[model samples]
Target: MSTSLAWESNHGKDPDVLIIGAGISGICTAINLLRHTPIRNFLLLEKGSQIGGTWNDNQYPGCCCDVWSHLYSLSFEPNPSWSREYPGQEEIHAYLKRVCQKWGLYSFIQFNSVVEDARWDGETLKWCSKVRVTGGKSEEFAKEGYVIKSDYLVSAVGQLNMPYYPDIPGLGEFKGTVMHSARWDWSKRIEGLNVGIIGNGATAAQIVPEVAKTAKTLTVFQRTPNWLVPRDDKKISGMRQALYRYLPPIRRRYRASLMDFRESWYDAAVVEDSDLNNTMRDLCAELMTKQLVDKPELVAKLTPNYPPGCKRIIISDDYYPALNRQNVELNTGTIEKTTETGIVVEGKEIKLDVLILATGFKTVQFMYPIKIYGENGRSLEDIWPSGARAYLGITVESLPNFSMLYGPNTNLGHNSIILMIEAQSRYITEMISQVHHARSNGHTLSITPSNCTVETFNEEIQERLQKSTFASDNCNSWYKNEDGVITNNWCGNVIEYQNRVSAINWKEYEITGSCAETLLKKDKSRLGRVVEESNSALIPIAGVVSMAALGVAAYLVRYGPRRIR
Candidate 1:
């Protein structure tokens, strides 16, 4: 649980890269750097005591992933021993920790260190990050703040890190225990107590069933209803686990099948009135009708008026059944205020012993409360006053040698985000390789996407989002900002994103510095080298030989053997 003393010993020296979070995106990026790129000196600054970004934060009752366990893991390090169709929070966290341990990532991570601000030093062509060490296992560095500089800076503090609380009048006056879904308090017991929960999104759907089993009386205050579908979660048998563990091909095939099934639902998510969308809507309706057959009144209140994919579809098998309990009640009224004892809705105050806020994260604000200055002392906030924008959701226009993972317009509505993160990690490592190549020649270098490239990319994204279900006027979800701009989700399927970011387009960027001329001359040769080196581990020997042959052909077509290294 202590911070890495090795990282502390080299505090003043500059690393090759500095990553801001130790979650899935950050850890995946670090692994890619170690395995693919030649950048050895990199640091990961984590605000929490442990890794597993979302999984570590959310510990409420019934917290689990909606995605299948097999499809949700890293492609290179697939786990064949999952206990269920969908893994719970603890299992996912443990998997990440094991992956970190296997890849030796703990030595590069500094826990309990919060990044205050980071500025791109145009003169030095490096990112100077100011970090504050919060007292925990890192208490020795808590007395004062310190600065860490790196040639490249990556912001992996993802979209869903900050919790959002509704501005309800007099919410602080309540004397009972209050808790957000992300920051769960395990010591506070709600058994035999009348508990009330506000908001009815995916987290609330998971929580309602578990709390109803023990609470004296549970009241759910919902603002809007979400499309409810059957999760169909089941336990994985020991025989199946053993088969997957022993035969790697079977595990690979299983994971591929899950990914293909999930990808098939892409049309249902993006096409508002397509046949697939209608079919999914019918399935969700059938699930609600069968689950709430006895309680006809509850079914009417739970039915969503908007389209199925307007908001995130809730997958649950027990939510409706939990609502059918005699002691549970669903309130879809306007919240006027909150009193000392409970919530007041529609001129009536419902007494409660505990209150839970299931309101989700501030996803639209990609990176807030962290001041970031780019070239010529330009603030990132000033550049992105409207909303965050990045070319391929990785590099911004004004930020030089800076990249982001899981940034705007990269979140998925139907498939696993791990796929997107992997694509991004590969793309980023390739870009960093260019900078490292320049540094090895004793010349400073910085790279950023052209303003026109970012603008054109975002224009296409926004236009495509207009045709998707998420941009519907009838629904308000976390996928957008207050201005109704679709800022969080990608407009296409995962394959499209992966292919788009698979290779770096040098023409789209504005590369500068003392080595810009030399780097530009060797772009094709460097690209070929990166492709052959980075993916050698993933392919079989025959595949690698074939790829090497293809790489030589590409090199010969572009430049002669004299340019080969």
Candidate 2:
């Protein structure tokens, strides 16, 4: 008889605090909260069975993080034991799992529990959350769900959860083994077969070079040319590795240093900082042209007409070389449709055996379809149907006591999101501590920026967007939504954002509850922490009352002066 091996469901287990999605950001958020504050009502809820989120899902060939390994790990919990300068997906996944296990986050984590909806009731002052657990013979897909309540709600369901495939004409009719890089089918081999890859984004750029060696013939369909920077991705050496292991502070110091400078790469491009921006532009243009300098036709096809730093720039050490390979052919033409044998381009059918769609994620759809009702029974999707806008990329105006791990415009096209993730996680941890503090003090606090403030921030983002490579009308990029609004990237320095988020002012929010109401009902005139009103009114009122009382006392004394005597 075959053995039945499986893990049980993580439903109906209530903790002090419930976190949705056990991604890197989620794990980091939990870790930071646990480290700082004494409040411990936290539970990490993951949709998948394991702790590693993206690292677990995207297992494509040669998949690796673009950021330097030294800067990728948490600042507080540094790993001096990285194998490479840039770690692969497996290593990254293993690192996260190890961190999760080390901190005993698994005990708090409920795997395979998918969150469906969250509604807030003012009377209860608790967010009623519904979660569904996958896998059970008795439970049907339609009815496998549960409900829970918590003081605070956070949506860490990252921007890259849902995979998107273009509605190309003959997608359902294709007979080949087609899959996204995020969900790479590795059970079967790719060696000695003709393969055609669609979209030349970061994933395709990485996969093309790796699969080229195995596949007999390879073809890449390029919708638009991306500005490429050669990645200095190589193995981490022994001496440096030893330093990291022996001296952990080295990693944090390095990350902080990089965050200050590299994240502002866009500022130069946008500001027209001539000496710096012009130099970078000229250099990128030169490289773009020189990449296939001899092949002018290919260069022309590959070179972007938009300014540098407009789109999410990719780092490829082998993409240019891969395109020059004998077995590979770069197709710059639009793919009209797909035939059973292959894809058609420019009214001509090109034959291929396998089709791989490296077409990225549906990132613009932030927590859509998942019903999240906030303070006023208002849905998050309804709040930002056009796109999400937040004060500090954490708190939404109407969504009270809720925070986002990596909210709108926080993505770094130049630096590692890990840095941004850590900053965001820490910021959220601080907010969690605030919630914990409020609960302890019998107060419900909400840090809501004015609509004017939110609008002003968005306007600034748009102004910067106009100068970004992402906003170029020359091409379509994933950094934008259907409306072409660049809501997914940071057009400024991350360090500045870090500093702004690091400090929290109580004045920014309206703190109200039993404690607040008790204090507030006492006096309307004494609301502020300090008195700033003019003293002339108070002096005149006291003087006039004193004189009136004196005159009345004198008259009564004269009339009754003989009684006491």
Candidate 3:
């Protein structure tokens, strides 16, 4: 780790890497850096008091990971004690804490530390980051903010952390308890109260069922209906857990099977009205029909007009059944206004004691409120006026030595995002290794993708997405931006994405600064092939190959190779 600080602002620890957002991406990046790479000194700045990005923040009732527990976890750390097939918010948060403890990552994390700004310095070849220091004793430091210098910046701040409240008339005038599902207030009472939830996405799918059990009257405002599949969640038997704990290979095989199954669903998500999509739609329609047998009106209102893959598919066994309750009602009318006590929809005033905005986050706006400047003092916001784009969803053309995990176009619609995060983290870790190798040889290295590369990549992806289900004219989804461009999701499957991010192409980037002979001679014994390959196209292919090999091994575990007869 380099402790040298070329520029002075606030006297804080100067690390080799300064990671923003201590969520899943941040933690996974840190784990790779500490264990896989040569980099030791790195700081993880989290806005909240704890780690576990999405899992820690979202604590609403019935909140849980839609993806199965076996495959949703980090590849390196497998948990054998998952209580359910799909773990809830609290369980996920606890799993993260245990992983952190196992790796001793607590020392690297700074809680209540929010990033304010980050600017690249061409002179020192370092990133000077200004972070808002909360939970600190010094009021002056907290107000003015503190500074930290680093050779690399990893943005692990994911897309879904920041909650998005809709622009509704008189939303503030409501005298009742109002909150977003992302920012759930557990203390607020909902028992026997008339509760109104505004949204029909995944969160609402979960909350509707859970809240309907106790609410005196439950009304769900539906702007769009989602294709829902049965979760079929069940408890992991003790014997299965024992098998996972004792025979780790069996667990790995199961995880790999889960991954392959998810990857198979990619076509259903991207290819419009494909066979997989039809099958899913039929299955869901059956589930809906079975749950709401007598109420044809409710069925008609709940049925989606668009194709199955037009929006995200919600998974729940209870959401449909909950809608059939006598006390529950589903409204598909436009919300006109909000009064002091309730909301008016289509000239009907529905009185409610509590309003829950299961409306999601500002996903299109990546790295919101945090000002970032690249080479020549160009702002990231200015560069992305319409929407965000990145090369391989990891590197930007102007932001040298800066990488983002789970950035634009990297979000998955069919599989676990944890797999994607691991892939991106490995790529970023390899980049950090190159920077460290250069610095050790008394040379500063800066890297940024070419403009043509980013433009070409984004254009190709956008073209593919235009034909996908996300671009369906009949339905509106958050995956598409206001411009109707699919900026929030990837066009390919998890394996394809994993292969794409497996290795960095040196030709795609413009690398500056020459390697000095004097400094090279001092480190000659450790120099040759490692440093040379770092600047080549096939640089760090071993890491990628290793991941690919794991996939192959998983295949063999399911079916062994045939012997010669």
Candidate 4:
């Protein structure tokens, strides 16, 4: 057992796996590799100085997960002591930190080490990642930039990390304190000051109510209104927490119930005119009407013209009521431009002390700014001319031994994304297992999904997505790229995706440098052991029975109906 960071110096050998980003997907993939596979020699390079990826970045006021607290967490490591139905940013970040500590993952992580580029070395059959050690605690490294080689490269750098600032005419000239919602400055004071927040997406919905309580005047500039569903958030009682902690079965069942309820909304998300979609739209409309009954004029401004699930649906109980506050004014006018003092809305100046751009993230750019090269030094940018696509949102066509978690077409509209992350991690680990087995037999293996397989899979995904609400003609969302390609969201439910990737079809992948003879001999040796252990008369019968039983058990373990976890 080698020390984590000292592997480079002590062993003088490349790690088996190198994962980028220490966010939810990255951490989950690392944990899966540790728990499930014998490939323990792995490292995680995080650009930030912390483990929690998005949770570490976005620390804005009223920032919390829209999904249920129980469902948002890892299935293997459930937290029974959630304070509320939805966990806040601080709590989520703390949970991730605790999980990392519990798994002893800190030693394996190199903070502030930005991955500049990763190129596949065809001759060596490995990935060479160019890493820049940025100034921080990570400056302990002697050199500024260095190369780290690995047998496999897993990109867990999620889509939501990079903040997207809209191309406003004078956004750079804003004299007052300007901030993106993802990079909120906690030190900046908001009390008794006039604050103007641009964009009314999910982040804006969460920020509006909290800012309205403190700010003297809060102006929300909405380009378009999002369908706001009632969060119905509630604090967990002490007794309930005790029950969840003490009785593990109850907690597991509760999480299952949440998953089931969330999965039931898949039709609403995919089908534009589905009955469930209509029901969901009605529920959101009713919530908006009930919350803003006293302010009908504001209701007209807040109502969305697009389909319910066309854009990301926001879950907030306070957003509609917050708009009714005297200090809060919802502006639906066209923003002409911005000056040093304030923004010009409908050719009128609305002076503001603070300007907050709650403009979300670059969701379509899967792994941008990081130059990734595949076979023949073909760049990832060149491969994805239109947008990113993967065989199952995991393995690419030409990128051998490369996998991505939360890649293109994997984002969910109704259910938790943690489920998808787990599936991808498991699939990637299985691929790594094949490599490990081959290497153990004195042979190196390079695995890449065939071009035909990736193309067919993407074609099916896009064809299905065209019928979904995400690609609806009425609305444009972050889910689609500049080319109008739906690149961010999965077209099917969580269970469907899980079932699709639950097992690896080796036929779909092009495997090279595999030790066929050695692997075959090993299988034969196992069969010989089973035969030798049986009696001479019953040897044939016993061997067949044992193999049949093993096959059945494996099938049940993989595909049978079982607990949600």
Candidate 5:
């Protein structure tokens, strides 16, 4: 049955589910829902015109996925014809478009639609959504202003959409161009111009190589150096693509192995063993030396003083090489502030026509600026005074039927987020299915995870992360927030995350309330379990392995004096 309801203003505003953010994770969630459940009435609310969120937002010169191409995609829909080992933004965007088309998610999407605020209605146990759609588009609701309702809410809005800029004084006074990497404006050309880039993170490193090719003189200002690694990138051969296309398990195994290895390195970096840290540091230095010749000073400038995993590990095929370019200057001096002419670093004042702020995102401030209200007249803003915390990066205790796809502490710094996204979809789809089962049987259902379980879950992660490379007293990074709290990233392997999501512990949630008062089968919890033992042999071990144990050991050595964060 196909039914189209006008905007919330029409009669009573209602949708089966309201999905916020039509990004990769969000789109994936929607597509998976179509594949698994009988959910046809969900509204995909995208603030922008197009479907690609981050891909649309980040149009910087050298934009690409950090993870290898084979692993970065969905397990069900493997693309054999990946041009490069690591696909660029355009390819990833096109892949997403194809995925959407294959699953037919376009009709369900509402372009230019924004959710102003969503509140939980306790009486009905539904989301009372206050939304706003662009005017002059379609007169849906009787008047056009949005106030809708939905049985469930899915917050798939990604973390990286918000751009971060250093509080450089006198930034506006600069007559020259200033742009964040995420908000790159192509119309304002940087051709033959002198450009000053602030903060040498992943984006900065990537941008330097691309912009250097164009700019007359490019100066990269560094606060602290990140551990840079060689990305052995290459175009996927036709034969390799054919192999993955015909034999999917090969791709799957390779992806799993890669994820596992990366996760293991996390342990080595974060673990308390000075021996391990030293080994990692030595290995990183060796790689740096291999890239640059006869420039020990340059190597030192690029080498991180902090632990390997403290900040994000820098990976690039061009970052170090770009620095060696004649026009490019890597400045190790401190940037006092911005001047109208250029950035005044220490005593030297380098003039620039364009200033690019490749300084990462406002990750510490989770779900900021945007207003979100949960159950019992409680605002989501008010709930997270310190920082955002979600049960499995999805649900809040009071917020029933509300799910966040790529929520807090669920981020992985090591491997592909695609793996996590798939698992999340599976878990969510099961929950939605249960809701349907509940309606068929006579009971209202709201999936609420046990507080003990949730708290233990976070505590365990916190304990493990404290000892991991991510929490070491290294250079500050986007990985760590303002308060030095690691709010993002799963410290475990992608495989472990898959198991956690796939294995549903129904005993953990309190399912109460009914969608419709009717006679049907009792909505029993569909308990799940990990298919294979700890040492499963179907896939490669490198893809999804945890650094949890090593991280814990490292924490004990460093901060045995105190508790793990």
Candidate 6:
């Protein structure tokens, strides 16, 4: 075992909550805990030394969020000073850091500590987690393994962190610098080197455009071409930035406009063979044709055979133009194997100084490589033999007191994920509040979504997904599992999902414990307290104004200009 500070840390000391990753989801969860709940004994475990999960890991050239900056950020903490309409990786990472610092979350985060496994201890009524501390050179068990306990567990480890490299034969024997786009090697100079990149999804699309500018020769192996949409990314004007900083109403109006525009494409995502889908397909084709006007041969190879939303629509203004470069060659031939010098494509050896695997992540493998033992020692892998499912993509049956953010079936095809994360965070905080209230009243509450409830929800969503464009067999995408079930996406619009996860129904859960009645009473008491506290804050203002005038003022504060701020 490697070094771990098991003895030094507060290991075995039970916290209120244990969050797995330090990504945007994890940060949002922690912020919610700090703002909305009274529970302070919580910890965040991050395998890496830094935060910003995907943003920190990906630093490749031309890498930026496809979602616009204003809409991609948290609703409570908007960044009015974005350098571009779409901020790059460094800026996003810095934004996360600033949020964490503002909330004083660094003290609660244990860096370089990876969670090995989490087990539900039935006797203790708590989760016993096994953690492994990395970065220490010494091979000592005391410094390697640690145990911590928490009443609740949160899996905030997002989908894209794990890099997927194809098991091409003789890949290990290739005498070249091999890397994945997710794990870019900045040290290896590609200024004049021949580079061969495999896969042509979103990551490859971004990588190729930038690499073509510097590489002596670039070969992009396309398994399937994705629909290219013009990004039209531009720098935000100074006047707009100043207005957003000074006028809250203007900032909110702009955010709403961007949000509405993104939502308008939801019809194209879900309804296959509809007018919206056809119109989008035609527009993407026209855009592709405009970019490759000079090279007719490259146009066909770059065009997608699948529907626009079947695979993710690539957002780039330069990817099509980069494919027309004289030094760049698009190879659609099947790769036979990797030779000692280069990759064999249709029996021809294409020599390369570097080989890059741009294959996407294991999207279906939710809570992957981590053994999550639910009630009676049932593993998560055994439960999701076909694919992962959850009631509202948050809670699962048999996995009591465990919740996930950005989990299965919650990924959106038409909108920003930050919105989803906020919704999920609020829902998780509500559940945490429930557990806290119950436990304080001497009840050992174990909550799992009723199996029937989860099944019904998954069945309805999967059925709708079958009618969606992602069900098209034209391309093999990472969105589906081995069973061809679309486990990575929400089959409806973002507004629908926002409404679904906003509140939790008590009847939907299977609650246990001898003190269940007492817990219910406490739940009502908590609700009453919230109402009374809200009314108490309005008393002083109520004293100076007439009843009708006070009511009007209160309504204005709730839904007017003050609401925007």
Q: How many residue pairs clash per model?
A: 0, 6, 0, 0, 21, 3
Considering every candidate listed, which one attains the maximal TM-score?
1
* Residue-level lDDT tens digits of model 4 in 1-565: 2222434764467788899999999999889888977777888999998899999999999999999999999888889999999999999999999999999898788888888889999988889888887878556642556778888999999889899988889988988999999899989999999999999999999999899999999999998888876666789999999999999989987887676666656665567887667766666666666667667787778778877888999977788888878898989999989899999988899999999999999888788778899999999988888899998899997899999999999999988899889888888887777777777677888888898999999999999999999988778899998889999999887777887887677777777775644433333111011011113333224334434433443343334332200
The predicted structure with the larger lDDT, 2 or 6, is 6
Q: Summarize candidate 6's per-residue lDDT along 395-421 as a digit string, tens digits.
A: 988898999999888998878998888
The better-scoring model by lDDT among 4 and 6 is: 4
Give the clashing pairs for model 1. none
Model 2 scores worst on lDDT over the 10 consecutive residues at: 524-533
- On TM-score, the stronger of 2 and 3 is 3
Q: For residues 1-565, could you state the per-residue lDDT of candidate 3 as single tens digits?
A: 1222211223354888989988889999999988877777788888888899988889999999999998879878999889899999999999999999998898788778778889999899999888776775433335556677898999999899889999999999999999899888989999999999999899998899899999999999999888877676789999999999999988887886676556656665567877656655665676677667556678777889887778888878788778888999999999999999999999989999999999999998888878999999999987787799999899987899999998999988788998888888888888888887888778888878889999999999998888888889998787878888788898876666777776566767777756433333332112111111111333134334324533443343233332100
Structural similarity to truth (TM-score) of each candidate: 0.91, 0.84, 0.89, 0.90, 0.87, 0.90
Residue 146 of model 6 has an lDDT of 70
Candidate 5 local accuracy as lDDT? 0.72
Q: Against the correct fold, how does model 5 do in TM-score?
A: 0.87
Q: CA lDDT of each candidate?
A: 0.84, 0.69, 0.80, 0.82, 0.72, 0.79
> Candidate 5: worst 10 consecutive residues by lDDT?
556-565
lDDT of 5 at 184: 89
Q: Give one digit per residue, the lDDT tens place, for model 2 in 1-565.
A: 1111111233333454668889988998888777877856677778877877788888898788887776677766677778987789989888998898898887777677777788877776667777776754313432446666777777787788878888788877778778888888987677998899998988888899999988999999988887776565667778877886787567555655444334435443443433444545555555555455445567777877766566656666677767867888889888888888889899998887788989888888777557878767888777787887776677776666677877788877666676677777766666666566677776665434556666777888878777766677777776788788887887665555665666554445555555545433433221111111123143234334334433442343234232211
Q: Name the top lDDT candidate.
A: 1
The deviation in Å at residue 93 for candidate 6 is 0.7
Candidate 3 error regions (>4 Å)? 1-12, 136-143, 516-565
Colliding residue pairs in candidate 6: 3-143, 4-143, 4-144
What TM-score, to 2 decimals, does candidate 2 have? 0.84
The all-Cα superposition gives candidate 6 an RMSD in Å to the true structure of 9.4
Once model 4 is optimally superposed onto the true structure by TM-score, how far is the C-alpha of residue 407 displaced, in angstroms? 0.5
Q: Which candidate, 4 or 5, would have the higher lDDT against the true structure?
A: 4
